[model samples]
Target: MIINKILNVDDYYYDVFMAISESLTGFSVNELQSTGLAETYYQHILNQIEMATFIDFLNVSKNVLDNAENKDQLKNAISSQIMDNPATQQIAQSVITLWYLGTWEGAYVNDRSYKEGLVWNVMHAHPPGAKQPGFKSWETKPVNSNS
Candidate 1:
């Protein structure tokens, strides 16, 4: 007789979620964790989906991370296995949106998520009204701006 294993939220799953998140968002683990939203995001995902679906998503993500040999291969694996697969595509896109936009299903997760959104970092600016760069900060060019 075969038994179906039940999965629960735990350290292993959290680590796998972070790993997959790092891959999907192209953000380093340190950078992602520094936002202080990793656990919240993980729990948010669980709340949005059934445990079995989350497990399946993480399983495919782990497989891709473990087997890919290089950056290009990892990208291709993610594209084919997670993004192209109907079973996981929406979840994967949601994860990316959660990181970059601080929203899930078109709603903001929280104030902290808005303040810590990756989109701000990518654009080298702070979220409007969430963080003030400084007094008269806009008068100066962004520190990292090429122009």
Candidate 2:
């Protein structure tokens, strides 16, 4: 129920991550439906921050999914990463500012190479800045035949 509501507010932005938000945050069915997905997801992430450390966030993000208990916690973490509120949105925006290529989908390296993804394709559109790396940085140096 809560997950359904989160999906509605998030406009289906988050995938099954909403389910973890519902279970961990205890958002009522009605509450989830009423609030924006970012609102709830942001709150959920903040909760995890209190429970985990920086390394914990990174390591757990990459590993927790495999563990059952932590997997439950990881669900909320994924949902939290989707927050787009003005306050927290800045945090998400900051990353793009630091690395523009990571958010650029259309932006390519050299002339032809790996395809980039839209900044807002997954998370929110990154803050404006130099044409840096596209989403996930598809840009790569040409292969060197001479080695």
Candidate 3:
């Protein structure tokens, strides 16, 4: 929280993201935070821009959310900005996509690879070609003989 305060994004910054993500992805804030999704998203955003500029962006985004009159207005405000700015839009979309798909598509941020992606958690399935599903899981169904 201290870090958030230091950046002047202590109040509505994370909340706005939580609100938008939960509404868009149908995932709880607790789930996102517990899974370290928020942290990963923040790290990816930092990877895209400098720390100071990222902090400034968060502050401005928070202020925009704070000025919205209601949930609909908040969504409109956020969506419009995302549509208007290509660079920031990519960052925002990346955050949402990572939460649902568990894949970080950023050119940078090598720390997050397919193995570490959340898709495994969401799907409850093994990473294809990385590991087997389980003993005989691949042949659970009838095999085709056409080949």
lDDT of each: 0.87, 0.36, 0.58
lDDT of 2 by residue, 66-139 (tens): 34355455555445542333433343333232122322223332221121222222343333453344765545
Better of 2 and 3 by lDDT: 3
lDDT of 3 by residue, 24-131 (tens): 455655666665546556556566667666556566566555677877876777777653577466656676666755665644244344544556666766667765
TM-score of 1: 0.88
Ranking by TM-score: 1, 3, 2
Clash tally, candidates in order: 0, 13, 0
Q: Report the error of model 3 at residue 133, Å.
A: 10
Model 1 clash pairs are: none
User: Could you give candidate 1's per-residue lDDT for residues 1-147 as a string of tens digits?
Assistant: 111221343567787788888889999777998998888898888898899999999888888888988889989999999999999999999999999999999998988999999999999888898898999887998778799
Candidate 1, residue 24: Cα displacement in angstroms equals 0.8
**Distance from true position, residue 71, model 3, in Å?**
1.5
